[model samples]
Target: MPIAEVFLGAFLQVLFDRLASHELLKLAQHKGIDALLKNWEKKLTSIDQVLIDAEDRQLTGDRGVKLWLEDLRNLVYDMEDLLDELVTESAKNKSEAEPSKVPFLLPSCCFNLSSRAFMFDRKMRSKMEEMDNRLKDIITRKDIMRLTEYNGQRSAYRPQNLPFPTTHLTEELFIGRENKKMEILELLTGEEDDGTYMDIKKIPIVGMPGLGKTALAQQVFNDDRVANYFDVKAWACVSDDFDVFSITRSILETTNPQLARECKTLNSLQDELTKNLSGKKFLVVLDDLWDKNYENWIFLLKPFRSGVKGSKIIVTTRDREVASMVDAQLITLEVLTLDYCMELFAFHALGVRNFNHHPNLEVLGRKIVEKCKGLPLAVKALAGLLRTTNNPREWEDILNSKIWDIPEDRINVLPALKLSYLHLPSHLKRCFAYCAIFPKDYEIQRDELICWWIAEGLVEAKEAKNQWNAGLNYFNDLVQLILTWGSLRVITVIYL
Candidate 1:
């Protein structure tokens, strides 16, 4: 399943609670819509388990099952929009109503508002009836559709017993990143022009989550030339939270553990950092940064300013906006070519860099490699999956499996991708999850995506002057996070 369904049940439950709340229930009763809402609540609750079952089966990547699940997901979105409409209308009517006064001596203005509310209520009741009928029709298809219930335990794509190094970077196992490593090294060691005022320069290594931004940064950070060039070196994995004090404390710890243990306040930490870095060139690697606040970034860089010229900070992140905020030179990593991907896959799958010994597996192996889409992490993961299974039939089975069908827990790539998704804000998560509704490689128009986001109520209208601008901002944030392509008119949801 696309994992969006994992959240669908909870979202529906929230809506149910909102509908059943005292204020809304009283309003519904007054408008003669309570009975309809009661019916919806009952039907929705009954089918909640069905949605969960469907979600599990969808993970198997069966086309028919996926279609059915998409239908259910669309209905959920529609129901949510309808609920929002009802809440908005109710609030508007309450605001327009006259204050409680002599009931018998109500003014004509009050009568007009009452008539409008009644008409709106009737319209809403009709809409609810239509939705109820649609839900009934969808439920009746369950038996005919033969939706399979998931019974097997959740399995990830990668094997648990495999000796493949998924987390740790071994220089020998690392392939296809030599050129990128050299480029980053050159940036770190290369001198800046005298015209540039900043003493410490920053270079951001940005790419999609599984594109190996961290690994590449690790390679560069560990390079002998880099180690020899700088007087001091420190590393921090600043994932998500970019607390100024915590980061300063980490830098202090990396440079001098004793000073870090002794310093309790931010001022003391900064003083320690300054004392350690003053007049000495240093290299700092802030890996996996997600913060985009420009002020916060500048505040973090204050102590680094005391370091000597040629001091460098290499920030590895999935967001280009973070790179821009730090005024860093950007080195965006691209997906590997087929040649390098094949080489990496062979090394993991067959314990060699080439498939000469198993010529029979080459053709099938290349087909499997194509499914990886030149992502190094995915290539390594699939290779790890095939390491023990040398049979041609087993290779073919892997080649045929959909990426979504692969269990994320066992698969290094899927889990890495899931982490990126999990870190997204709730609104962005909804918007991005909805993209799963499109077919893989489907070229999405920017405007159409924004419109869908607005319709789904994923983007807050009050946050911007109009829904269009708000949607644009949401889209840009997703782009910055490397979740989607970076183009206005064209974008594609990368197959996870």
Candidate 2:
């Protein structure tokens, strides 16, 4: 999701509240632009109805929707500034004069003035109408855009390929998880209790997105112990919309590129793959499997069945269903503890496992890791963001920033993380977005958070008596959905 999209829904909620306020509308009427304000409110409501859909499609890399969102964003910002100016002017007028029952939002001195001021009013109306026209254009183009996600965009921004999917090891680059690596090694190298084996077994490493499922797989796969155990090993990234032929070709390319090149169809590729793995103890790591189509999964397994008994395939995925569909014993990767995450953070950010000498940053660094909620990809990306800057305040700024507010190019772990956010109910999106205003280290009380949610209009107050309980229920739903790494690390995050 675009950073600007983060606040759109919530900001619109507040904007509507202000626009409907009698005092603000009186000011607009005083300026003789009340109709323009009303029109804008209506048009923005229309856009808000489809804002979630537009954001969903924007992730699909739709050029028109992207442009439309950019236009909406710029227009929203300008409109907000204009509203702020009006409010400030109205406040000044109120403070200068006595409060009367007249209900005038701004005094006559603001609008009832000389010809030069009347000319200024006319120009302001023209500008307001022009902005409304732009909003109208956005609506027109939105209809044309049919803003929705495409099939391919599921994997468009996801990191699917292994950095070094070969015999060469990147274990040093992977921090911590030695115990996990050992457990997987035992599974990979150990035999059945009956001292027998099937043709091959699937070792599914399942976890939520941004948890470093691939990195863990890489750590285990590239270990010297496993490298010396299997006769054949290949790593293929099977992201969304997994195609049998494409995956087969990728698997074969690591084994025999020339023969893989010769294969042009699913049949040819699988047959070649079968030959490549036949009668051999093979280890194939299918990294980032997103497809849950059991038929396709079973079909893709045809060649693997030809491998020698005790051969194994390690599968890394964010979905448990995909892991279950593989009919394998799955290993759930737990969230790294704060200690492990700090080390991982420092490693990626400073190319070492500890902060050692950066005393000014060590505390901020831990808070940054806590804000990351111990998700490795987010931790690494955010740490990488600080790798170039030593300023402690810069670290603080990033910590203080909302997940979406950070520039995409600087650190982008949110694409995968946003999937969890998208699954949220419409009301919860605003609830979650508004929570970004809280300080990262603030220890929140349930009652306080509930009050804020109700005040922000993110959730219906229902009857005032039940509003607190309603907010409490919504907060609980968020807790169940949130990626909480440690029991004590409870915090509302835009990163999901």
Candidate 3:
């Protein structure tokens, strides 16, 4: 029972409650429907506290409580379905009876219609009573469980007195990226390959979000060997939106600031790029690319072909598909090792490479570092959170807390990770959110997951020959986006 499930239950309750107030429902109120509606509303009104408490308990790994919460969630879903069915039936009846404009003009037919309405009312009343009994039973079980609301005070993980810095770290502060730096440098400065038609060689640095891809690129970009090898250099942050002209303009400005100030048209921009890069070995770094359109990549790289044979373009992206589309030699980044992770975490948290001054906190710090799973960004983020705190209890609390449970606005690292989730389309969002039901590090079967998505009505109903194919396409899109990692042959896995 994730917090997401609780929020979803609350949302469904609100929707069904609104549906309970329709005109047809009002017309049937006197047939014992009004009392059932009142009882349902009364039971649902106080569920917010119950959901919050369940969420808190789930976060703390209260298995027994989560089982109970799951039961409540299923009941809520059943109630929502029943309410929706009632509304649909009521609408259908209203629509089907609309042609009879003058009931008094046909007395015998009116009497027959009244009799049918009475029968319909009796059936609905019986259904309502059955639903009411089911709800009452659930309520009694809830009371016996004594699931109380969360009464503990909430506090920010980061210290209130010390404001966290929002800027990127200097090279001196970056740790455990030396091997990656050397590899990228070798690729950038290596000898040009022979018999290649493309003048500009492309090298892509690919990894998950916040794995320090940009930092590694920046280190290589500013290195003396790289700077000396290329005559011209430019860097651009090509985030989700990949506008060709904007990127071209940015390249021009970085290469020659004076030319960019005067160039106004695409033709002029291309001319300037040619003039500056022609016959010169150059390096261009494109950071955070999300676009995978091969045509767009070709268009963006068109002007760079005029540069010398050794000229190279370095791309940093989370999506392997983007890397593939760019047709670059790939330099994939892996997570840091435990030792390096600890070094990085300690540097930021206690201003040292080791916890020598605070040896007593070392054990707690190690536990927190384990939670980071060797991801540099996670390590850095947790370090930032603990920088202002000297309490062992605070560190322990973070060690035990689930990352998703943390408030997004407070944790800088989470928003970076969440951006990938937020950018997904509505259909993909539902599919991805549904994965929260699985435990961490669980190997998810692609076919089983798709089946579940279809069953949940998350997949859109189209006139496709196979609906599972549509669901598979949705899963592939998520994989292409690097939100989940696996292969078609094996299994799909989500880190969170």
Candidate 4:
């Protein structure tokens, strides 16, 4: 859809809200809709005449303003009975939620004034902004823009980006758990009907940190049924700060890269998104959520009310409380089973099936995998290291090491992975450590982080083809070493 379509959609919504508030039932019986329609027609005709004159003189100075007026007029004319029905339903719910006073209606006079001001070509952007401000003021007076209360209890964003499906036992690594995955899918995507609001399914996948929540989510995302079921699919990585703009951009980029490019702010991005998702069956996956506060989630999800029935919002989080707050049908993920664990282990270790050839290596490999204790990160990291070396001595040495013999905490691959970290240039080391400040799964901005690294004397500006190129290469090298992760653990510059 075009930008003109969005503006029109918003206008129709405003009109519908106004109509519903005016008590259409009473209007049809008393004032009569024919009279009301006539009134609207007369006002609209006058507005259209003014817009037509503005278009003729657009070459003088009003090109942008005239274009905006035309778009707004087109939007009003685009309103249909379908939109009126939705607004009526929403108004009924609103009235039930708060019944103490007479409902306030949207003012078309305000809209028309705004549209006319937008037609003034003398100060294009300023005039348009002024019109928007006026419109917001009217909406606020009507109590539609009231700020709701929110809680701020979480101290930090504990992001969990699991590298595997599960880690209960060896079987978990080898045999894929399609059945369990589906059970989780059913729980997360079940439909529920309540009389007041139209029924919609809400599924949430929750689990402990590093317990394969994200991996399981990936499986659901790629499932054939899910792909065909949802009309609109979007993925938002809600790491740490929960920057609305970045998440919205990620959603748009999932299916509409062009729209993502056109968005620069959260409001604009959301406006574009709401229009794209309206009346469509949408499946939105919000991954790595740490903010458990209900109010935050509600505000973010408000626009989703426009989505079609059966649309589901899948949230992957470590906090059960977050799942509850979002009113989601919960799928609590647990550790992988023994067999499944082994399968995942084998995937990382041999990189292929039929790994029974080397008797000695197979025995040692099983022992090594058992030591990993179903943690996919440990298995994958070890497998990646082992794949490069052909020496049996190296494998045996790894099996016999104190690092491998220590408790799980001491056996953390961070220390072994530190070998890769240690090899980095001094400047790159500082750059890598800078990543610690970010929450897990936080997408780091390329230019900004690089600039900080340069400012901190971590990267010499004179070392490369150009400062920008040097910064990019240094960032890329660190990413390749797994010192950071994103988009399948390959570093892509992200802002937020």
Q: Per-prediction RMSD in angstroms?
A: 14.2, 18.6, 13.0, 28.7
Per-model C-alpha lDDT, please? 0.67, 0.67, 0.65, 0.52
lDDT of 1 by residue, 99-164 (tens): 333222234454344777656655766677677788887677765666444332122222133232
Residue pairs in steric clash, candidate 1? 1-59, 156-407, 156-410, 158-410
RMSD of 4: 28.7
Local error of candidate 3 at 56, Å?
A: 4.9
- The alpha-carbon lDDT assigned to residue 452 of candidate 3 equals 85
Most accurate candidate by lDDT: 2
Q: Give the TM-score of candidate 1.
A: 0.53
Native-to-model Cα distance after best TM-score fit, residue 448 in candidate 3, in Å: 48
Give the poorly placed runs of model 2, Cα more than 4 Å off.
1-171, 192-198, 404-496
Q: Write the per-residue lDDT of candidate 3 for residues 1-496, one digit (tens) a residue.
A: 3434423432443334454555536644523355556667778655544554555555446676667667666667766666666666666666445333332223344433556654654565566667677777767766776766533322222212322221122244667778778887887777763433355678889998658787787788878898788888888877767878778988998778898888888889988897887777888988888898888888888888877767888899999999998786789988888888888878878889988889988999887777667777667656755776678876765665444455544443343233233223446655666776775435589899998877765666544446688898777765543312111111122222
lDDT of 4 by residue, 1-496 (tens): 1222112212332343344444554533331233444454444434433332232233234444444555554535343342354345445454333222221232334232333332421233243335445444433332331212213211111112334322111222323456758886675456532222344566788876546666677777767777777777777768656666677788777667898898888888788777877777778888878786767776687667777777777788878887887785688766665555555555655665435655557766777667656655555555555654445665664555433333445222332342233223445544665565565456578789888766544454554447667777777665554522212222111111
Candidate 1 runs further than 4 Å off:
1-56, 60-171, 192-198, 403-496
lDDT for model 4 comes to 0.52
Per-prediction count of colliding residue pairs? Answer: 4, 0, 0, 23
lDDT sort, best first: 2, 1, 3, 4
Model with the higher lDDT, candidate 3 or 4: 3
